[model samples]
Target: MTAGTRGEMDEAPQQLPGWAIPPSEGFTAADLDRLPVPAHTQLIDGGLVFRSPQSAFHTCASYLIVEGLRRHLPGHLRVRREMSVILGLRQRPEPDVCVIRAEADRAPDQTAYEASDVLLVVEVVSPDSEERDRKRKPQLYAEAGIAHFWRIENQSGRPTVYVYELDPATTSYALTGIHHDRLKLSVPFEIDIDLTEIDAL
Candidate 1:
């Protein structure tokens, strides 16, 4: 793997779980745009990721934050779900949610979105994704110099939102705050979203 100016690590060969099959090799960004819409589908680092259909609870929680961000964020910020984020060389991941600075060329065919363009990324934790969302993905984001990252854990009866901001000194993210009540995410956006609405979902 070629490291960019950011000092990225080589992607270690991953051992897939029994249920997680290896992705087709040589998959490119164009292939991602052409894939048929499937239930609970996403692209991880250019490989297809398929999850079981989201439970009613999961859908509600996901929709809650997605809609809230759309409704409240500043007009100069863009909010999207399942949008492919092009990580140079190593991968392109479709995070559960992403907030980016507004751009004139917001097209599906765009091959890359630089780290400087991204403002925040959010992932909703599922049983199968705990290790990745909690341990692995954050490291990748930090190395890419993404400014903010959040992991929303709802594996239990109640949900928790873990908020993190990048720490430049260590090239890692630092926990800013975690909230189980009404959440106020004031970042690239000028508005506040009450995550309690997510529980309603």
Candidate 2:
């Protein structure tokens, strides 16, 4: 008989990732921390939403917006890109770009921000994220009491910004402006961005 004939192999089942089998209720925002690697993921209403690969237009548009905000940022505010905001226990979504209070700080180890810290949230609508950007996300952000949201759409390679502001009485966003070519604003602060810059990008 072979020496190993009497031995039985280990039968213990290996554990799986949180996403491999989500809980009955769905994943909590905190569960995102336990992912095996830094994933391009977001949690929406306890669901793990994986990101699709970004297109070139998505990259350029986001970059230009961030640069514009940084160049004109006031002393009390700062800009961040692709960072998750903790909107609720089960709601954590990454805005493509955000303007946050400076007090949130830039700690190298900070993984998330409280929704209250964000002054404005910007979503550069990817083809895959259009519905969320246009509907669900704005609802979540509004309910979280965030005051401003912008959705950017690519119109024949041009960036058109649809801006919204929170209505205090209803706690929902109201259409504030639809800007093309140049986006200038005054509510959050004095600002102007040449939307046409994407043509050169």
Candidate 3:
């Protein structure tokens, strides 16, 4: 038996021991939940993708974004961190942050948030996650009909947020604004975020 990286098993699917079943056919969210793996694993296109451990900087940035949203959003809207959002049958991804509608009818035991319940999805770009955050997730989120998407990028040691709003007619995102130090938005609600505090951490 060979040990893999810290969070993932190194053995190829077919090479796994007798006790381990290969997801050759494909994997579902339920399959991922049952597997003996660490946290932060996601299913994309029926395949398992284990995320790399987040750095201190990444964690701090994520926390700052969540805090900013929570402080400004109305009481009816809720913000969550690292919540799993089910995009479709084959995709379940956990974004860095999510803004969702508060509903009395929502099941208390629901395993994952439905795409329809999400008002916005936020991704903090780490060096290893730039492509997925910038390209892949945006496409998937837009297609799933999530109304808003925010991507936070670290440039020269400062965080800059790029905001996008979905275009229903095209099912794509239109760049609404790029913000540094402060973020102000009028859609879904009116709010402003001061980013300077994030840099101090």
Candidate 4:
């Protein structure tokens, strides 16, 4: 999808094949490091999912959120992009954006941090990633007990921000907000953003 500025993202529609048989061996955290970073690929569910490169608008929006979160959040919060987070020994997801408390970011080495170390996870919805971002990922993050999950759809002339608080009962997330006029996020970071600026990008 191509947008002059920010318009409703023209997401590429593709349904993931239903699971029939489980894999004999799932990937581990160590496997992630061994797998070379490709041109446009991410590790998902013990598999390498190929994704298209992010668009200019998406990249800008991600940067905007990171900067805003950093500026508005307390000293304890750390904002990052493309950070490898290990939800479990068998699960390592490289989220587009993540926020972890100061202490969690204190690991002495490059080992991927665990989900318990993450406070929030954010994904920039791209044309080809509608399902993964809106559906698959939320479930995974929720299962990891992440307190906050955000989906930023930058295609809409204005960015559509979906805020969720993990629900323990369903092991999923409940949409806590739908910010149409502007972007407002209260968890992890207490900040409000004007969608007009996101669209103008």
Candidate 5:
């Protein structure tokens, strides 16, 4: 289904007609490749979770953040969007934006990035995905040992960024800062951004 299409996430039948039998051993990353699902769907904890269409604000904010990171981040890191990150045998989540070590070995046509290669993962909170982005994803990313996480939310109708750094001893994130107008961060890399400028783009 195309973006902005409603009803793409309707519940699937327990059993299908053709060779699409539900696996008894639970879903895996490989299963996502074989199954026919909406393009925005993610495989989370052995279930197919479909994301609703992104709003204009969501898309614009994601683009601006990626552009900001690319301009400021060092050459040794690569920024990407909507790429599936394999966190475990059964958990492969697609973050809105992600940064990874540039030198990490990857085939020319790798479909999913290994979690170990990821340096940071960013999720842009939507009305439908607030719970997953705020709670569920942080827990999963921490478990996968991803060093950094960022959550973007709308604050009074403007984009705001919340930054986090993983504390290894606890394997949980500590809030680093919350940005509204200006965002200057030192961890993961130093970058200063004007939040208002992001939306202007």
Candidate 6:
């Protein structure tokens, strides 16, 4: 209301780009679609998280898992790669691979699936996302009640799969096994994949 106040406002620095600012309460699941986020953008705890460029190891491991899973999936399940799963209003994460209920694939235009619709979510570890791939994400996925999860670590350029199952009583994941060289699992359906398959990539 005062001339001095108006002059100060005019002299102030210009505002930052809208995307550069973090909302007080962070972004919502819907913001992922409404905003001009880059490819593979994720919403974590209401914060926007962008993905780092993929490494050869990441690409190879993802391919091996996606194809391997697809081969063994029951008719009721479908395999999708790098798809977003909506865990909550503030949590929309794009797992490296998701084995979802076949019914969840309602249309080719669908951008995401509800957490409940996902039977398994696999995250192949990356240098930039170690913490998330190892900890934060699995926690959210468990809380969202995804039945099975696998965290693939790059061990000496080979994919090492760490599988987990959700423990509903505690709302957390219980590590079931650490697989190397070969991955064999029966839950969520039977599948045997030679981890060395990545070597072909």
**All models, RMSD in angstroms:** 12.2, 6.5, 5.4, 10.0, 6.5, 6.2
**Per-residue lDDT for 22-82 in model 3, tens only?**
4676777666566775577777777777789888767877888888888888888898887
Q: Estimate each model's TM-score.
A: 0.73, 0.89, 0.85, 0.79, 0.87, 0.90
Q: Residues 1-201, candidate 2, lDDT per residue (tens digit)?
A: 555653434445678665557788887878888865356689988887888999888999999899888878999999999999999989999999999999997688888899989999999999999999999999999999999999999998888999999998999999999999998999788879998898788
lDDT computed for candidate 6: 0.91
Candidate 6 vs. true structure, TM-score: 0.90
Task: Please list the C-alpha lDDT of all candidates, in the order they appear.
Answer: 0.71, 0.89, 0.82, 0.74, 0.86, 0.91
CA displacement after TM-score superposition, residue 119 of candidate 5 (Å): 0.5
Instruction: Kindly indicate the candidate among 2 and 5 with the higher lDDT.
Output: 2
- Predicted structure with the largest lDDT when compared to the true one: 6
Query: Using TM-score as the measure, which candidate wins?
Result: 6
Whole-model lDDT, model 4: 0.74
For residues 119-183, could you state the per-residue lDDT of candidate 5 as single tens digits? 99999999999889999989999999999999999876578899999999999999998899887
The window of 10 residues in a row where model 1 has the poorest summed lDDT is 18-27
Worst 10 residues of 4 by lDDT: 14-23
lDDT of 1 by residue, 1-201 (tens): 446733555556678554344345645545554555454455556566666656665667778778878888777888777665766554566678888888924676664466678888888887787777898778888888889898888845555778899999998999988877667766645546676665555
lDDT tens readout by residue for model 4, 17-102: 44322257865566656555453355567666666877887788787778767777788777778877877656676778898877
How far residue 194's Cα lies from its native spot in candidate 5, in Å, is 1.1
Number of the candidate with higher TM-score, 1 or 5: 5
